[model samples]
Target chain A: MTTVLHSRLLNDVLRDILSPYDLPPVEDVTTRRQLARTLLSGQDNGSFNGLALAYAVVAFCTSTEDGATEVLAAVGDNADVLVLDGVRGGYLLLPCAQDQHVGLARALHDRLGSDVWMAVAWASRRDLASARATAEDVLRIASCRAPGVYELRNVLADFAVLRQPHVAERLARMIEPVVAQQPLLDSLRAFISEDGNRAAAARRLDIHRSTLDHRLRLVERLTGCRPTSPRALLTLSVALTAHSTPQVPLPRAY
Target chain B: MGRGQPVLFDVGRLLHEEFLAVYRAAAADADGWEDAAVSVARRVGSRLISAKVPVAQVVVALRSTDRLLTEAMLDDGGDARALAAAGTALAAELMSAFCAGDDDGLADALLAGSAPDGAAAVYTVALVRGALADRVVNAFRRHGPVLLATSGHLLLPVPEAAALPLCRDVCAELGGEVWFSVAERPAARVALARKEVDEIDALVTSLGRPPGVYRIDDMLFESAVLDTPEVRDELDKVVAPLLANPVLVQTVLALLEADGNRAVAVRKLFIHRSTIDYRLWQIEQLTGLSPVNPRDLALLGTAIGLSRTNALG
Candidate 1:
């Protein structure tokens, strides 16, 4: 028999046998392990021919108890979509064009609420594992920002910083003095939020323009980096983001 | 280096040790020196003021120490740039200490050219206050050093000829009322200059002159009136009737701010010219002080200023 025909026959037999009784939810540890084994077996035996096509792997975090089931339901009768449970959240494998990943993630994000953080990456059948890994990496880096849908492109800078922890550490050390001074740190944040407009930053901080200048000067004196200079400002800005982001590693992808 | 000045000696010793510490930290690890250097610099700066070291002497000492350290590092094939950078950080911290009123000597040194690169010898002192004091101070800093004193007062030193125009530009750019006083003083006597400016500021505040740069000479009339206790009461009585109507009061104040230009005052109030004309008429009928008459306008401006001050109090 052809591989596609054989896989279809096996899937139909399994569905017919399991359709008679309610199966355990995917949240059950044994059931999840069984499903993982079955998927791995399918990869080995070519039981799921759909896995051979290009797909978008999405990794997401959800606090709700039935998050796995909810995600599956959100994916909603899409024969090409596959869901896998992981330690913190779960993964969705959608066999679709690369350009559709963001729209799909956005739809999932809307369904899952703003509290969910999701990341997407594209891969072919053979690269599914690496795609899952990339999605998880993007998710970890983008988690520092507001929880929402993210892709590698959306978090390239943070991913760059995240990859070289030593550089991040040095950048973070540069702002250690600023981090200690609340008013100076607040001023820097306001200056950045105002897109480097001194008058607007002053208004935001409710301080005089001179006072903002003094505080920024103090920040430069402490960090050896001028907040007004483009290179130095980028260094300070990235350093602050890195410093505030938690450094813990994410759990391994399934 | 006398027994009476042990604190100064300690400051010198601490600065020396910290510079060495910074060099060693930099040599041992590139990233380790910043925190150690910054904390040590701040501590040494605070000690420099607490010891009451003369600002000029402190400048000389810091520069001498930096040169000596840099030269020693050069001889040893170490990073002289790191040592020099640490010194700059130390000086910046000391400037901060001076701004915080660590010592009068330090403040004087900052105003005067303790360092060869300090401000000019005969700079004019400007005391700036208001909602835009910070913006004005920052703008003034382009010309010279700006020292932020207690109670949000900014002491700026600029050339005498540049003072009025600079203040005008700041007020125009910032679009807010910033009351400031400018007094020409020798750099050595900025503290005294600040007091004189403060007095002029007080007199101007009492007279309720429109927000702009003021000199003591410009406020001679207001000063003469402020000296009499009954004059304020009399001035208050002159505009009290106009004050009862907030709209008329606003129109009179706007006219004064616009220098008796009704068109400009109408633009400021965002009202029709006829409305402003009617309001000014109402003000004149109520207070017997015509906004159109220069002398009457002056009296009305003073009354409004005193009334605003009283309301604030």
Candidate 2:
């Protein structure tokens, strides 16, 4: 039942994604449209990368052995991942981008059933989070829909953690202060985006550090929270993440 | 023939398409997308599996719809004007899912147990993914223990033949008796969810012994030495002296492995041939068996193999 809950949730997202036009988007039609576009772009790139990551992906054809002439190359060294089916059931080398490579793992799993052993390498910090999120998302959502599809037994986590709505609701509260104080909010956003360097923040805003400080103080006063406080910092961080995250078009759950 | 099962063992398409399809179906609901997807997936999967269609065919169908739905989900990210541009984000999700071996596309539904004959089993459901033969054979082989990855489980379309041999070999090596059956993909799955539906399990149990449909076998090594207690004791007595002296035992075993060839034995033990000779001579003195003798060499080799196997295990 709980598994089905995850399936249902995924269905809602799929429906909205498939039928983006169904949701009325008066406030941010452009925003909604961009959201839909990114998902498509991501899908295209994902398939290529997904193929690369699969425990059972297509091996390259031989166009190798000669450097200057060949339509295709079957060089093992250039391949993204190496899958080994030896030490009993199976094993796989997951070619993952440190920061840039995204969504390859989950796609591979969904494409294959659950009997996969993967060794993933994240190329960057950004990818680390996405990879981890993707792994989590698979566990949470895979079986929720297809009970016997693949063999991912009972390792699903809370999908709300990755769901934008839950993040939006929580973040909405956090962003209220920014909404309450527009100028200071914009300045702070830039400052944080620029990585908390007061000089950079001020330079971006064409203001003195003292002025930036004073504005930040105004923000603290308005929201009863200081930028330095852990809670405030967390809220700000989450807000930035939420802001940056693509709005996935999800249908209104009936 | 001993190796590949393409459609059934695809770990990727199984999750992606299924998850995506469910997501699409449930996305329209007010409940969380998580809830909606899970609900839809389970509902559809349950119906499809229970509908009596061959499990493999059903899997293949799920893969296509899953991919289509997921493409739609990722499509959400394409709208740059939306609250947040999600193309990159959704793309990232899709990619990561693939890497995670959750690519449950349309092909998987048609893997195991031939397509069942009936309209109910052939509900024109959304398609997901279909894996190639070679790829799946390798996937199952590489993923060692399904239990190691608690996050997910595995569904393999093992030929009643190959799997049985493997199970027998493993049981023999593992020093235990193990029994398994085809698990009636559709029934075992549903039954596993219930308190293990007895009738299905019973049917499986009965079928398990039938030499074909669902099968179970064992590999038991009968010991000639253990046929009689005196012979067993004699064998044990000889092993005890060697066990008490690991150095002499190892030296003797190494020498025997080399077939009494001192140079080979020395190389294997990574020791001087003179040291090996000395140990060999000491073993002879203690065991009262000449290292050069054929009877002693055979006995030493067998004993060493048994000892090493037991110790390692």
Question: lDDT for every model?
Answer: 0.62, 0.37
**TM-score for chain A, candidates 1 onward in order:** 0.71, 0.37
- In the range B40-106, model 2's lDDT, one tens digit per residue, is 4444443332232243454355456445654575566422222122222333343332222223322
Clashing pairs in 1: A209-B134, A209-B135, A210-B134
Q: Which ten residues in a row are the worst by lDDT in model 1 chain A?
A: A1-10
Q: Report iRMS values in order.
A: 29.5, 31.5
Best by lDDT: 1
Q: Which candidate is the best by TM-score?
A: 1
DockQ scores of the candidates? 0.00, 0.00
Per-model chain B TM-scores are 0.56, 0.39
Model 2 error, position A220 (Å)? 81
Give the per-residue lDDT of model 1 (tens digit) for B128-240. 76755557656754443455544444544445565667667766766667777887766566656667687788877775666877775454334434544434554666667
